[model samples]
Target: MLFDTLKVSIVLVTAVTRWKGLETRFLLWKSLPSSIDRLQHFASSRMCASVKRCDLKVESPGFWDALGNLEDGGLDVVKKFFELLTSFPNLATLSLTALTLDPLKLQRVSEIHTLQTLIIHDCRLPRTFNKLSIRDLEVSGNPTEMFPASKEDYGLASFFDLNQVERLQVSKPTWGDPLGLFCTQSNSPISFSNMKVLSMPWTLSLSPTFPSLLTQCPVLEELRLFSQAPKTPSHSKFNQSGATTLHPSVAPHLKIFIGPDVCASTFTSRSLRTLVMASSEGRPHDIRKDVLPILTDIAFPGDLERLAFGVDCLSDPLLDYIAGSFKSLKNLSIFISMVDGERYSSDIHCRKMWISRLSSRLPSTLIRFDISTRFAGLNHSEDVSGEDLNVLMTPLSQRCKKLTAFTMSYQSAARGRTWAWRRSERTGYGSGQWVNTDEGVRQ
Candidate 1:
């Protein structure tokens, strides 16, 4: 039912990162006075029956955010909007960015009993009157202690109650407090007792090592350490200081790891099913030495069902290791940079070399395969054109019979082209087409 009145409440979300600048992204919510009018205009549409997700952004006088801005408009508008918002029957997600809420507004937000996911970014804190019922949370910035705090209010309820969140995505944990999202004012460390999925960016150097964090997220099943940089992250202080390798008992139930080379090699989580690693090209020459040893040590024979690797170079030993180890693998993506020092051959070599061997070595059970040369900066690149895709991916299609979808990407700021093949609609096995990537990576 909400689909019929999408624009009334939905912000036609676009890729903020790729947008021209802050001005372009927040065109809808630029500043005060007009802020409420813009929102009223956006939500002025006739009410819908049931909405599943709600995304709102608000901030102080000096504030500006991506999707829109709600600055200096006062709390009255926010209060009025949430009043109408909380009446919705099935609201499940609330993403608030750059908000500078005081206690009254925080109490108003706490009244939304149906919220299951809360995403807060670059916000100043305002302690809430009610405990949060969110099971999933994503925080990109600190909900720093807010302004206008009474001298004695520092001892009030914890900034927000995150103990109920089972799936947490964090940017920095700021010591062991999980960015003070946990509702504890004491000096004791918080336990993420119900946590199953934890994702952190490579820049998380707030406090504690991976082991210490894992101790809190004892039952964490999926660990994601994604980052904007494909090469070794410059701020990898966690692994540099001592948490270089994980002990099996730390994240004992860990089944999926998607990030840098914090080796699972010691013994294993014993049942690691999906390992998607972006090689720390701190040492570009050791594609064989660094990755294979860990794969050889931890991943059980025939256990890995999906594997995606971003490597300095694609090597025989690595491909051979994958073929030998992940017999049941169903989906695979390999990103290689062919610059001499960057990794494999230049420009994913639009020539023959590894294409033939990669095709032959990939497991028969794989349903989808993606291979590409993803270099940042669009510079010093010996590039390939879209016309070269067939010559590049044809060998793969011929060899891997089970591949229902195949994608080969050569994306840059300007080119904006992406090529792929999917099972033909008529035959259900051998047809597909090219598509343009949304918002050019360079834009």
Candidate 2:
């Protein structure tokens, strides 16, 4: 079954790649000089099996990209790689699973205007491919030197520009020089006017006024920024010339803001309705001062319907502040993890105080309430009784009379946590943890 699953997945990926147009370039990596034609026949045989079973189209060839193992050698066979890309004029999506793009070859590949989605993992683009037009992009690789250093520098940037992209996903070791590569700089001032959904890791030094550009997206509804900063402190000066200050123009139509890291406090979006500031590390100052204030100060285009606060620690002041933020909060979620405490006893007191405070103020306003706990104690013997959990969540049940969804879970039981809320008529905990309404665990 495992072997069959692997085979089926590979065939499906190959089919999707071929459909999106990635066939010829894929053949290049499989065929060697001595027996290229015969190997092509073998690949055709495998493909024919799928074609016979299901309807498959193969009218035009595509850039089938399969990077050779780098341990064998480093970028010595790039000429052959380019030969593969040029074979397919209609290649739409190129998947590079390894860090092995020859700069010149990437540039040549970019010339194919039919390319729509460029999914790169570990591999950097050839120097020539920076300015190419790819609408949907996903990149996962090391942060060190991801972008081509200069316009003349033969690397990733030479083949592509991300300013016009509609959907983008970037997960790297860190966010280094985001504006220089992803956003526009002074010399390369560009606009992602059509960009809608963006997901990236956090950085303290993202280019200036980049936050304000969120207003530029006419239809942007979802924004998720994951935390990627190191635990150690590093104070770096923000260069004045590199800063892009937010003025009036930005993503005016944005509706959902999902920030998973510590961002600049100056972010302001008038149309934002759902704000999710989720954190695994509970920092008191960040929630009480930085994030919560943004929601209270700005006025949403519509009533701010949903709000969630996810952190390792739950504080009464933060809870009070959140209760005062909006008059029309429909859904609310809080995940609290204890910080360096021996037992759940000390944390429970703090948690109860916050929960009680929320209960008093949230009766009329809140429709849904989600609260979870994370107990500390390195030993595996720790346990949380069901009665205790019921007692803890008791306040939420009483205060939120209009509550459509009410949930609570114990951290000791939910260790190594990965859970979601179940979607039933009223409310249900899908995977064993707390979740609000139908959105499924708040992104």
Candidate 3:
């Protein structure tokens, strides 16, 4: 799957091609307005040894400059680019960014039966959901960004049969504000009957577009909500509910959920294994209120193999809950940040117990454990000594016999040290610590 920047995605594209990720990553870094035509031309070229790659470069001084008047002929380029797909009979994946597609053009490309995965960002699509038969789709940008004003197009209601898509990831709106999922709600034909995995921004959960969208994908195994759950006017009331509760009867077969607190306690899923309940995007989580009381309240707690969350400060109860809830954990990552210049559990003994208790609870099946703690509130770096960090990591690394890697960092010390597991005569204790010396082959 493509690692889309606008989407809360990385793990979703694991089933697709390696080239597919690169194709999508390229778009995430920059718009490919000029690359469209050049990509089409490169496939037909045989004499690359004598050809000048510079000719395929963008003719426009900048991509933005090409947007209006000829858009550096971007529209014309994408029109011709569509024809290139019909040439690759076995082609199954296509990732494009920053382009536009009219209704007829979208229909023409949809006819490619071999296509099964489509990853696109910042592109204009047909007003209605046309018959695009892709199984895995990662999309952003508003549907109305560049759509034509045709009466035949009825927005997302006709984007194709939603049941055909098994995996879906959505990030930013195509353009401006989102198209609101669909223009007309009751008459919409969208369905997620076969959806197995879905990743979207947290803010969308509060928007009107999300309410109807969530109920449709009941078979989803993983649901990831990335980025900050912004306090937008649409769903401001749900802010206080962050990391608090899970909806009952939601995705009975769900194995992963990484995002903010959705409403209700109908969580009947017995297969959930990964739960990351916090605001990501590197934002500070407040210690004013207990950020994790919601952890104990999850309907079917425990049995999670991977867990992650944000915290204002470490506490005995919080660490204790983790040890009791998840016993067979393999991968764990924690995001710790300061809130308003102070640690919540500031007592020296409390901090030391947090380290010791946490160090003992790490399971042996664990391969990777990452803790990113930043003492942002302290006035001096010395306030958080390196010795304390060592006390925490050394035991964690040594005790977890199967650990493959671990990292612990403090904001004061910008360059966090990393320890990786190796097989042979590596520079480390009998176990693993990534000895940086120029010793035998480094692992």
Candidate 4:
């Protein structure tokens, strides 16, 4: 019965691809021995010539035991598997999950010169493999299991030795002294000369050596710090004085930063063009005081083009401060959280008035504006009316002449809606559209 099912499946796939004149460009498989035979047969067939990306995930212990049953303790079986994989001339991206990498087998796979991106998750790497020519590499593992809490792990170092790696993401490493692995203290630190983007997990950002490590990536253009949500509702506190100060000598070309609020005074990067202040999910609202000082202290560049704020930080006073601070700002996104109550409703009305006056209050150079609101429907209230929409759109159209794109969106537990307004240079004020369920307006 299993043999008949396999034959039918193969025949169906063959018929569909042949009939449509299509070639498989991507493939993902989750099981070993069972899928392995099919994968081998497919790769050897003429239809696989177009395959350029492949993902293989092996998490079952039985699969490894199956390999053990093969001759030469499964090493030859692994080698032959990779030998077939590298035969695909066009394969450029490969991802593996929970599969132990054999150095000898990887050496054979590394012969594929066209490979550009390699991603490995929760896998063990051999101490050394043939240097890959890939330009992008991502490695993720549990830090506690991957690296010893006290000593530097050379197992981690082997992957960084590839000079061709231009982008790197290290996530979920155990917090104890992992930054030391990137420091130059040993063997004149590894220089990622071609690295243009680097993303580190949040726990690593709190390390004292973080600033020093940034200094090493002279050409790094973008930095992203991914923070985990706290277990409690209380927000994390950052001392204004304890922020890391970046010297001009390091990462001089850095232009984009996305992470937690840092004391603006601590940053000296004149080339900064974009700043994103990340917010934790499920955090308490109205923590404006915690973020206000950071915004006020940051010496934002005159040419800063984009700025984003967390949901609870866009108070009236902060908006005024931003309007005055970033004269060259072109894109702005603000998130507001509104709850149902008399006081909250009044606050929303005041914010609506403030938003209507953005044409006069915001930077003249602005080209795009995005405002999103999360409405908590705790009390009975009227649905947003057409008149309210007109009040918000008219001033923006008349006053903000350079504005080209505008978006306003609202989300509630019951329903969600979005409005997009665009102005063309030729038609001027008369060109705009409102989109809603069963309702559409053109002006």
lDDT of each: 0.57, 0.49, 0.53, 0.57
Candidate 4 per-residue C-alpha lDDT over 81-144 given as tens digits, one digit per residue, 9 for 90 to 100: 5667776767787776555666765675577677788877666553455455668878776544
- Clash totals for all models, in order? 5, 30, 14, 2
What value does the lDDT take at residue 443 in candidate 2?
A: 21
Candidate 4 residue 218 C-alpha distance from true site, Å: 1.9
Q: How well does candidate 2 score on lDDT at residue 119?
A: 74
User: Over the stretch 178-236, how does candidate 2's per-residue lDDT look in tens digits?
Assistant: 54444324344446666888776555235564554454456666676655542211111
- Model 4 Cα RMSD, 1 decimal: 10.0
Error of 4 at 92 (Å): 2.5
Ranking 2 against 4 by TM-score, winner: 4
lDDT of 4: 0.57
Candidate 1's residue-wise lDDT over 312-406, tens digit each?
55766677777777888888877654444333444333323565456677777788887665445454344544455555456666666667888
After superposition, candidate 4 runs with Cα above 4 Å error: 1-49, 59-81, 130-133, 144-153, 180-188, 229-249, 263-265, 279-302, 311-328, 337-349, 364-367, 374-378, 382-387, 397-443
Candidate 3 lDDT, tens digit per residue, 1-443? 32211111111111323674563321212334555545555444332222221111122333333233233444444455565555545556666555445566576568666767787665555455446766888777555553445555355436656678898887775322223443333444467889898877665665544545667787888877665433311112224332423456567787777666443223424566776665433455543353555565565655778766666566655665666676677887765656333443443223334656677766656767766555544345344344565566667667776666665444433333333333233645433454332331111
RMSD of 3: 11.0
Q: What local lDDT score does residue 159 receive in model 3, on the 0 to 100 scale?
A: 65
